[model samples]
Target: MDGPFATAFSLIASGDPALMQIIGLSLRVTLTAVLIACAVGLPLGAALALARFPGRGAVIVVFNALMGLPPVVAGLIVYLMLSRSGPLGSLALLFTPTAMIIAQTLLILPIVISLTRSVVEDLWAEYREQLLSLGAGRLRAVPTLLWDGRVSLLTGVLAGFGRASAEVGAVLIVGGNIAGHTRTMTTAITLETARGQLGLAVALGIILLTLTLTLNAVAWGAGQWARGRLG
Candidate 1:
């Protein structure tokens, strides 16, 4: 507890194996989750923006509502589904990194969908007439709208990544925080702090903050570069 800063810095400088493993696992899980979310959400969002279906307004409202879904609740849903008595429990995905990734994917999917839908919808409004005049149907128009709004969509992806990386409750519940396996930075920090291992917790916290800041900075820079190129 005493001189936690010094201890944290020392641990980082020394490259403690356990700390490094936690950091690695956290990155792997969050990045995987974000990628999966983007893959599913981006196209779905574009479809929602371009298609004129009945009950569309209600559907958008539901997705927007889901954007604020609690992490623990999402975790609970996943836990039950993966539990032995649950429908999907036969595969035994509970308490694994795969389960953690699934939980995070669910948690961030709404963020990606909502943000992407908003951006694509706005872009579609401006480009709809020109696209129609050019003989472009809904399917062809989706790529054009998506490409034109790439910067904003990228920001949405970054936002999803931020949410996925910072979350603890869902991952902790599904991952079981097992050392050298599913232990991520957020879970490790919680466990260490609870066990009065302030130095280790501080070290993990510093690393997590650094990773988050660096990711945002890179995303901002990429957005700027894209804007410049597209401008």
Candidate 2:
């Protein structure tokens, strides 16, 4: 434990308030984005899974392709949308936490939607027989299928959180990485690295990884408990 590693440990042990504030803001933005994405994606994906309409395949393909959308591009799009000349410019959401959240939400929305679509679609096929036999329409089956497949769906949710938490490009552009305001863990790491504060950057990275790991573990455990209870 020397060099940056030593400094990182010291930083963690010191419980720096600035570090804690950054971590808290990061969680707030990422969690809020993930929640919003799930709220929209889960039901939409499930609907897509059950609904058979014209060009549905194309729509799915579009979403699947969007999963690979570059973060910088997402940030650029958000920036343009929120810029003073753009349609939503009147809201003045640019360079703010809300803007950061919007950017991250766009980044991870595809992941949640695509993954949920896949999981729900598979579950739908297997349950089609019983559900139809029970006179359950596609719309009616959505809730039941979602409930039974909740554990699997948690993977998509976690994936969204992971992506949102790790991405810096989108948030940086829309957030402006403003100190004590829109700055997040990812942006902070970028800032520290740019400032040549390697030790601080490494410490921030470790803290971020720990936070992500802890959240993932808790979510996984909760999913496991739900699965057990459902069984």
Candidate 3:
């Protein structure tokens, strides 16, 4: 353990290009997945919350349940669906970054929807009466409510990104952890650890933790700044 720890520290201090590439690739995939999640999930969540159609409650319930789904299950589903003999086999997306991104989007979409729904619900409760009293129609109030809940929406997005970036099981299965190709920090850590190369694994693990912490810190600071400006 001590030897692995020492080697891990040395690897970080050495500025290894391979390690940097892994980190960069992980960041790229996670950022892309999160952005895609927001683009699709935000409006859907807001609409689900503000709309008064039948079965809205059922949809919210399903989304909330999906928010707690196991990542390994999601990985298995994507792997099966994108495998060579599967329906999407012709696209040849398996073991690729795009596949990993797709799996991650599936994993985090529920979180985005559920969290954003909660945010919208709160805003609706607070402002619905006032907006309606002022002769504002439903369409006018929807955007206003969303704007007021911007901080919560941002927090939800940060939460989704955090979830996507930290996930290992799904990316590992769907991406195949191919070295110098589909390899990401999480996948690298898992492969190295399995191969008993504790030093490399621990090094990669440290890198992942550092990236996650840095991202969360930035999100927190940004959310605080946004709230202050709004106030």
Q: What's the lDDT for all of these models?
A: 0.90, 0.91, 0.85
* TM-score preference between candidates 1 and 3, better one: 1
**Per-residue lDDT over 1-231 for candidate 2, one digit per residue giving the tens place of the 0 to 100 score:** 367667767877898888778989999999999999999998989998989999999999999999888888999999999999989999999999999999989988888889888998999989999999999999999989888889999999999899889999899999999999998999999999999987788878988898899999999999889878887
Ranking by TM-score: 1, 2, 3
Give the TM-score comparing model 1 with the true structure, all chains together. Answer: 0.96
- Tens-digit lDDT track of model 3 for 35-121: 898888887887787888888889999999998888888889999999999899999999999999999999889989898888887
Off by over 4 Å in 3: 1-9, 132-136
Lowest lDDT sum, 10 consecutive residues, model 2, at 1-10
Off by over 4 Å in 1: 1-3
lDDT of 1: 0.90
TM-score of 2: 0.95
* Best-to-worst lDDT order: 2, 1, 3
The alpha-carbon root-mean-square deviation between model 3 and the true structure, to one decimal in Å, is 2.1
C-alpha TM-score for every candidate? 0.96, 0.95, 0.91
